[model samples]
Target: MIDWNSIAKKFKEADAILIGASNGLSITEGLHLFADNAAFERLFGDFKRKYGLGCILQGMMAGWPSEEEKWAFWTRLIHHYCGQYQPTPVMNDLKAIVGEKDYFVVTSNGEGHFELCGFDPTKIYEIEGNWFTMQCARPCHDTLYSSLEVAEKLSAAEQGGHVPTELVPRCPKCGGPMDIHMGAGQRMIPDTAAQARFQNFLKTYHGKKLVVLELGIGWHNQLIKAPMMRLVASEPNATYVTINLGEIYIADNIKEKSFGLDGRLDELLPALREACEA
Candidate 1:
C-alpha cells in the first residue's frame, strides 16, 4: 500500500537525509523485545509464575514507573541490545544511501544500529542514548564509557543460566552503580563528544535541501521526535518522510512536503533502493 517509487523520487532530489529507527524496526529483524529465551525461562521460572508475564521485556515495560526497577530493566536491555546485536540489511541499506550524501542520522533507537551499519559516528546523534556505553548513575561527567565487555559478560552469564557476581557493572572509579546513558529523569547524561559533533554537523551544514526520514518512530517519546520534527519543519526546502508500520500522521502545515508510509522498513527500503538507482 506504500508508494516506494514516489518516496525514492523524493529522496533522489533531496540534498541530505536523516533516518530515525524505533522499536518496531528492531522487531522486524528477529529481535524479541520481551520474549524470554529458553534458558532465561528455565532459570527464572518464578518470574513467569509471579508476574504471569510473557517475558522480561514485557515485565520491565509494565513495571518501569519506579526508577530503581526501571534502571535494572534498562541495564539488562542495554547490555543485550548494544553488545550482542548486529544491524539488519535494511539498516545497512539506509546507512549506505545516506552515506552517499551530506547526511546526518538522529535516531531514538538506543541500539547503536547507525554506527554498526557504518554511519559516521560524528553524523549520528543518539537522542535516546546508547546501550553500548554506561555513565555514572548520578552522571558525574558528561562522558559515556563503553560497556561492551561488561555487557558481553552479563549476557554470557545469563545465557549460561547464572549471574556472574563479577560481571555486575559498577562505576570503575567510584564503586557506585553504573547505568545506561539515557535521557530519563535528572541523571540523564548526554555524550559530550557526540553532542559536540552534532552541533558541528548542524553548524557546518544549514540551509540545504534536507530530508528527515523517520522510521518506526512513535509518540511515546516526544522529547526526541518533536524537536527533530520542528527542526525539519523550520527549513524551507526540508522534507519529512515517515515510514511506520501502522501509525502514519504528519503535521498539517508540512503535510504537502511530507510522505507518510504505513509499511515495514525491510520491504520498503529494498524497493526504494532499486527505484533510486533506476
Candidate 2:
C-alpha cells in the first residue's frame, strides 16, 4: 500500500526536486509509441499498409523509399504530437507539487510536454533531443532549427503518402536534407547546453534535501534510472520516490528512504497532488 501521508511529508520537506521520466509517462498522456492501437491505425494507416509498420517507433526507425515520404511521415508525427499537444492532468498535478521549488527534469521522451506545460525549458534536459527542433542530416553545422511551422505545412501538403519534393527540409549551408534533432545519432545534433545545465543543477543541490521523483521509467533504462538510483544512494539527504504502472523498484541500499508506488499515473498523480496540498 502507498503511504500517502509519508510521501506528502517528504515532498513538503524537500528543498529541491529532480524528475526522471521516460516512455511510460508518455503513455499516460495518450501517446503510446510501441502500440499498434486503433489510434495508431487512424493516424498512420497509410504507412502501416505500405511498409507493414507496427507502431510509431518502427516508423521512426524505418528506412523510407524517398526523402519526400520520410518527411511526410515525420511531419505528420510532429503536427499531431507536438503541434496539437495540451498539458494533461498528470502534468498539472506534477507542476502543482513542484510549485516554486528548485526543480529540474531529465527525460528520454522527445515529445516536449514538460516545456509545453509551463516548466522552465532551461531546467529540462531532454536526454533524447525533441521533435520541435530539426538539424542538418549531414550535421555540417551545430545549429538546430524550429520545425513546428514547417511540419504543419508539410503535413497539410502530403499526398499519396509523400510530401512534395520541394517541401522536404534541407540545411541552409550544406543543402543536405534535414532530420529531427532527436536520437538519429551522427545525423542528429546533441543538446550539449541542456546537459551542462542539468549537471550544474546537481552540483548546486549536492547534499541538500533533494527528492528524486521518478515517473514511468522502465527497468532497463540505464541512462536515467540507474544514475538516479546512484545519486540517491550517494546523497544521504536525497530521497527516491518512483511511480509507474505495474512496476516499482527500490534497490536495497536506498530502500529506507525510497517510496515506490505502482499504479496508473492518471489516478495516482491526483491523489499525490491532494496529499501534497494537504
Candidate 3:
C-alpha cells in the first residue's frame, strides 16, 4: 500500500524532485505515440486513410511516395502536438506539488511536454529528439535548428492531405532532407545542453534530500530508469517512487527506500494529488 501522505510530505520537504518520465506519462498527457484509437483517428484520420498508417509511430515509419506527402504528414503531426504548448491538469498538479522546489526532468518523450506544461526548459533533458526541431539528414553542420516556422507553414498550407513541395524543409547548409532530432537514427545529434543539465543535476543533488520519481517508464527504455534506481540505492537520504500501470514493482531490498504505486497515470496522478491536498 502506498502512503499517500508520506509521498506528499516527501515531495513537500525534499530538496529536489528528479523526474524520469517516459511513454506512460506521455499517454497520460494525451500524447499517445504508439496508440491507434479513436483519438488517433480523430486527430490523424487523413494520414491513416492516405498512407494506410494506423498510429503516429507507424505513420512516422511509413515510407511515403513523395517528400510532399511525407512532409505533409510530419508538419500536421508536429503542429497538432507540439506547435501549441498547453498546460494540462496533471502538469498543473505536479507544479503545485513541487511548489518551487528544485526539480529536473529527464524525459525520453520528444513531445515538448515539459516546456509546454510550464516546466523550465533549462532544467529538462530531452534525451530523445523533439518534434519542434530539425537537423540535416547528412548532418552537414553539428548544430540542430528549430523547425517550428516551417512546420507551421506546412500545416497551414496543407491541402487535400498534403503540403506543397516548395514547403518541404531542407538543410540550410546542404540541400538535403531535414529530419526530426529524435533518437531513432544514429545520425541524430544528442542535446549537449541537456547532458550538461543532467550532470549538473547529479552534482547538485548527489547525496542530499532527494526524491526520484519514475513515472510510466519500462525496461525497454532504461536510460533514465536504471540511473535513477542506482541513485536511490546509492544514496541513504534518497527515496524512489514508481508509478507504473503495468508490471509495477520495486526491489525487495529497496522496499524501505522505495514506494510503488501501481495504476494508470491518469488514475494515479489525481489520487496522489488528492493525497497531497489531504
Best candidate according to TM-score:
2
Clashing pairs in 3: 129-181
Please, what is the TM-score per model? 0.79, 0.97, 0.93
- How do the residues 84-107 of candidate 1 rate in per-residue lDDT, one tens digit apiece? 567778876676666478877767
Which of candidates 2 and 3 is the stronger one according to TM-score? Answer: 2
What tens digits encode model 3's per-residue C-alpha lDDT throughout 158-202? 987778877788888988888877723788888998899888988
State the weakest 10-residue window (summed lDDT) of model 3: 246-255
Q: Best candidate per lDDT, number?
A: 2
After superposition, candidate 2 runs with Cα above 4 Å error: none
Model 1, runs deviating above 4 Å: 1-6, 32-80, 157-162, 183-185, 219-221
RMSD of each: 4.1, 1.0, 1.8
lDDT for model 1: 0.67
Please give, for residues 56-82, the per-residue lDDT of candidate 2 as tens digits: 999888878899988888888888988
Error of 2 at 226 (Å): 0.2
Task: Please report, in order, the local distance difference test score of every candidate based on alpha carbons.
Answer: 0.67, 0.91, 0.82
